[model samples]
Target: MKLKKFIISSLLAFASLTFTSNADAASVQTHRVQKGDTLWKIGMNYGVSVSQLKRENHRTSDLIYIGEILKIPQTISAYEKDLLARLVEAEAKGEAYAGKVAVATVVLNRVDSDLFPNSISEVIYQKDQFTPVKNGTIYNPASEASKKAVNEALVFRGQGSGSLYFYNPQKTSNSWLRSKQVTVVIGNHVFAK
Candidate 1:
């Protein structure tokens, strides 16, 4: 009876080890960032967050130079932790930080929509999705206001009314946009649901 019990235990342990090894093998994959590849795009591809990429790579700025090698996390939990940490840091920077997070959130929303790419990186790097990233906004050094907006959005996270749309009232005179749902009015930006 003791031999039989020992054999069963050994089999169980072997099975557990095999499962663990398989799980670990499936958990991580390597990615090389090519020219025009944004962290957001990579995160989207790996189902992680831009912040996660930044944290994993110890990046202090969102401006990812060309050919930066990044390790993409394979799990949503790890990605969320990375994003939350980055958001917290951005909030510490102020409104501009908040705006950045909010901007990230908008990309995330688009990812959820069938009309947009299925990942953060893809949505952010999508044609005309973000002007700052495409036109050198990320490299322009986030403004105090932009930083603050980023922090606020990170903390607010879909809590400030339902406004998911935003535009510069001065730059855009589109009447249709004006008719959209307005959620939060912060600084020079207006957020709509």
Candidate 2:
């Protein structure tokens, strides 16, 4: 009876090990860097941030060479995801559905940009960056549309490629913003690089 119990335990342990190894293998995906690929672009494609990519790959710099392999992290923290949804709701309330997604895309674009912060919270809360945060509208509950838009933005990256700034042409008199080349105009806002 003791030998029988021991054999059963050994089989269970082996099955557990086999399942864990398979799960880990399924979770990880490798990407070979292309000539024109930047870490920002790669992260966007995988719904990850450049910093997360760097940390996962042990990369000290943004530099990546052609043919370099990178592991893409598939999960984002719940807090960060909620923050994005809130920002989208506050910023794009009353706007068209596409416009809401576009707004979220711009925030993601900024996170990927060298000129802006590397995270969602930092990009949204940067001084004078987002009006919703300044006016405390960001604390309001996110609309269903806004939440969906954020998820769509994550799945379909680069929808706002080369766009880092967006403003209502009617509300802003900032000469600097006016000078930026417009990438797209959705609803009432103008997106620019």
Candidate 3:
């Protein structure tokens, strides 16, 4: 009887310790708003969504005051990171390094935009959204340049543009895409708002 009680107490103690450690590993991070900071930019930097950031901080509007501290919630999963790298490689394999990064940035931008899907995979695999996914090139191994671009994009966020769309103007005859205000022209692709 005494042995059973001892074993039960030990298991309970072990379970408590495991739970505490797991909780500690995933604690939220806080960001101090800078002069040029926006919720979209902040969320990009931290691999979270603007909506998530606002919800965690109890914000009803996008307005974030400079010098205010906001809690940044969870970052992106490893699977999503890999998926973004593959999409970048498939979309901009021959483009310049900056252009590759810009391509990844556009996807991240769309994640923050209200008109697009909320996650990286969703944005990439949306019906008729990306040509690579439709043609099976997205499954190809990611190039080193593409992986680096994804890392840089996550670090630098929008990279000085609020572009949510990009296309190779030479290959695309879509008049609607041409009509959107251009943000930057990197390599063969045009990044637009």
Worst ten-residue run, lDDT, model 3?
A: 151-160
Q: Give the clash count for each candidate.
A: 33, 0, 0
Q: What ranges in model 2 sit over 4 Å off?
A: 1-72
Number of the top lDDT candidate: 3
The lDDT of each candidate is 0.56, 0.84, 0.86
- Per-candidate TM vs. native? 0.44, 0.64, 0.67
Off by over 4 Å in 3: 1-18, 21-74
Name the candidate, 2 or 3, with the larger TM-score value. 3
Q: Residue by residue across 1-193, what tens digits does model 1's lDDT show?
A: 9999999999999999999999997766768768878765666456555655677778888777666567665443444434433432332234444455555455445555677777655655567544454555333344445434433333333333444456678768979878888766655666675
lDDT of 2: 0.84
Alpha-carbon lDDT of model 3: 0.86
From the highest TM-score down, the ranking of the candidates is 3, 2, 1
Model 3 residue 101 lDDT score? 88
* Range of the 10 consecutive residues with the lowest summed lDDT in candidate 1: 84-93
- Candidate 2 local Cα displacement, residue 161, angstroms: 3.1
